[model samples]
Target: MRISLDGQVALVTGAGRGLGRAIALALAGAGAEVVSVARTPADLNSLREEGGALIRPMVADVLDASFYAQVEALERLDILVNNAGGNKPMPMVDVDDETLDRLLALNIRSVYKTAQAAARRMVAQGSGVIVNMSSQMGRVGSPRRTVYCLSKHAVEGLTKAMAVELAPNGVRVVSVAPTFVLTPMTEPMFANPDFSAFVMDRIPMKKLASVEDVANAVVFLASPAAGLITGESLAIDGGWTAQ
Candidate 1:
């Protein structure tokens, strides 16, 4: 069944590339006007160039608390996608204070701030959808992925809490938790044979979930098809969580 979002307005964080880019494009293709937020000018420019009138570049750090007002004023934002996050490989014990802080700020705090801001706007609008990106690691566990897993688990928690609170306002919050998507951030991990095996072995499909896989889930949650799905996390991990 084809889903369409003809009159919807959306704001997607990390829209420069990877899962974010895929989600933004999918939303637009389904007829939503998308506000693409990202830190890099070139990535945002690329989206604008490729998306034409369907996409608007919204440059702002998701970490910025004041960006909510900017976002609310700029777009109706019928849909919101929290898809920004990253952290390099590090043993849990060896991870420094600075790195941990930075990871938490970008992955966890940013998602919270953006979702909070979007929730207020959505509540006022009286109808909206918010899709937060998470990971199978959030539901399961893995070695060396401690920080990333922690950040995503927090995302899952936020989604649940916001869904319950925002449901009264007609706002639904959901999450797409994926395993080993091919994004720039994950390139190095895929290159490492041991890491790749560690990831693939647990996944029943023995393959990576594409950006499109995660993006499609985001679009579904943002659309009417998922009108009843709230505070639920849909895992696209090829059964990694099942394992």
Candidate 2:
């Protein structure tokens, strides 16, 4: 089925690069006007050039109060992709307080605040879609991803709770949980043969998901095609979590 988001406005956090960049482009390609947020001016400028007029580049940290002010200034927000987050792989015993706080701030706190800001506009308009970026790690544990898993699992719970509370207001909340996707940021991690082999063995499809894979899911979920899909996670994990 063909999905179109013409006339809709989408805001994608972390859109300057990697999966978020792919998602922002995909949304614009699907006919939505996209506001791309990121910390680097150069990256946002690059995206603006590539994405053309449909892309509005916003250089701001998602965790900043100024970011929320910018979001509040938008006339309308039809879709919100909470894609700004990171992972620090370290043994559970090696997890430090600072690392844990940082991950939680970015992965959970920022997501919640961003979604809350968008939800207000959406609720007033009486329709909107919020797609929280999650990870397969959210559903299953890994040896060196204790903090990453914790933050994502919290995102999973947040998605559901937000969905339940906002459904009556015509706002939808969902999550896109992807497996280790092949991106510039992640390609280096696979340089280790042991790590690469371990990951390859776990994925039944024997390959990492591409940025396009995750982007496609986000676009579909934000479109009318996924109208009834809320409070749920679409795993683009190449059968890894299915194992």
Candidate 3:
């Protein structure tokens, strides 16, 4: 089915490359005029080159609360995708306070702050949808991912909290949690056979999720078809945590 957003405007964080880029394009392709924000100017330029008229690339660090406060300066945004986040391998024992701070700031805190900013605007409009990008790691724990897990677990919690509050104001909050999706950011992991095997070991499907797989879910949740859905984290993982 075609999900239409013809007169809507979408704001997607981290929209320069990787899964964020894919989602931005998908939203635009479905008819929403996209405001693609990212920290990398080169990535934003590439988005404009690739998506042409459908995407309006904005280079800004979403973690910078100041930028998000002014995001309303753009056309009234109807859809907000809190897709910006970063991760690295680190065992909990060796991770220092600074490391934890950075990880939380980039992954979890950014989602909350940005989503809150968008929610404020959405409430004013009396209609809006926000989709946060989370990781399946948020659901299950693994070695060397304690901090990452913590951040995503917070995402799930915040999604629930924000959803209930936002629902009353005509704004819905939700999340998409996926396994290791194949993207430029994860290409390095896929290059190593050991890493590849390790990741596939948990997935009953055995194949890494494609960027499109996650993008499809984002589009659906953003559409009117999912009107009744909110305060939920949709898992697109290939049954990885089912066991």
Candidate 4:
């Protein structure tokens, strides 16, 4: 069966690159008008050039107050992809307060706030879908990603809570938890043979998930095909968390 988002409006955070970019393009390809958000003007411009007229590039940081205001001002929001986040891998002992604060602000706080703004609009209209970008790290622990894992775990919990609270309003909340997908951000991390080995060894499939893998899941979750799915995380992990 074909999934279509025709006549829908979607907002994707961090859409200038990686999985976010792929998701925005996919949603547009499915006939949705996509507003792509990112802090880098260059990246957003490039994205717009690549994704064409259906993609509206918005240069804004998800952590900024203005971002929420902008979201509130949207004519209508049918889908929200909370995909802007960061991670600094370090051992638990080396994780400093700055790193913890940064990760928390970017990962959980911004996600919650963005969803709140979009949900308000969706609730008023009595329909919408929220796709929070989580990670396999959210589902399971890792050696040097304590804070990253913490923030994502919070996201998982937030998804369930929001789904329950918003269901009555006809707004669905869910998360897409992907294994390490090779992207500009992760290419350097995987460049390390040891790190690559560590990741590959954990995945039963012995390969990383692709950007399309994660994007397809987000689109499906946002589409009517997943009407009954909410408060759950769809893992595109290549079975990494299964172990």
Per-residue C-alpha lDDT of model 2 across residues 78-115, encoded as one tens digit per residue: 99999999989999999899999999999999999999
Provide TM-scores for the models: 0.96, 0.98, 0.96, 0.98
lDDT of candidate 4 over 1-243, digit per residue (tens): 669999999999999889999999999989899999998999888888888899998899999999998998898999999999998889999988898899999999999999999998999899999999999888999998999999999999999999999999999999999999989888998889999998888999988999999898998999999999999999999988776
Q: After superposition, how far is residue 139 of candidate 4 from its true place, in Å?
A: 0.9
User: What value does the lDDT take at residue 156 in candidate 2?
Assistant: 97
Best-to-worst order by lDDT is 2, 4, 3, 1
**Model 3 regions more than 4 Å off:** none
Q: Over the full model, what C-alpha lDDT does candidate 1 score relative to the true structure?
A: 0.87
Residue 107 accuracy (lDDT) in model 4: 98
Winner on lDDT between 1 and 3 is 3
Better of 2 and 3 by lDDT: 2
- Candidate-wise lDDT, in order: 0.87, 0.94, 0.89, 0.93
> How far is 238's C-alpha from truth in model 3 (Å)?
0.8
Stronger candidate by lDDT (1 vs 2): 2
lDDT of 2: 0.94
Error of 4 at 165 (Å): 0.2
In the range 161-228, model 3's lDDT, one tens digit per residue, is: 99998898888889999999887678987899887888989899988889999999999999999999
lDDT of 4 at 38: 92
Alpha-carbon shift of residue 176 in model 1 (angstroms): 0.6
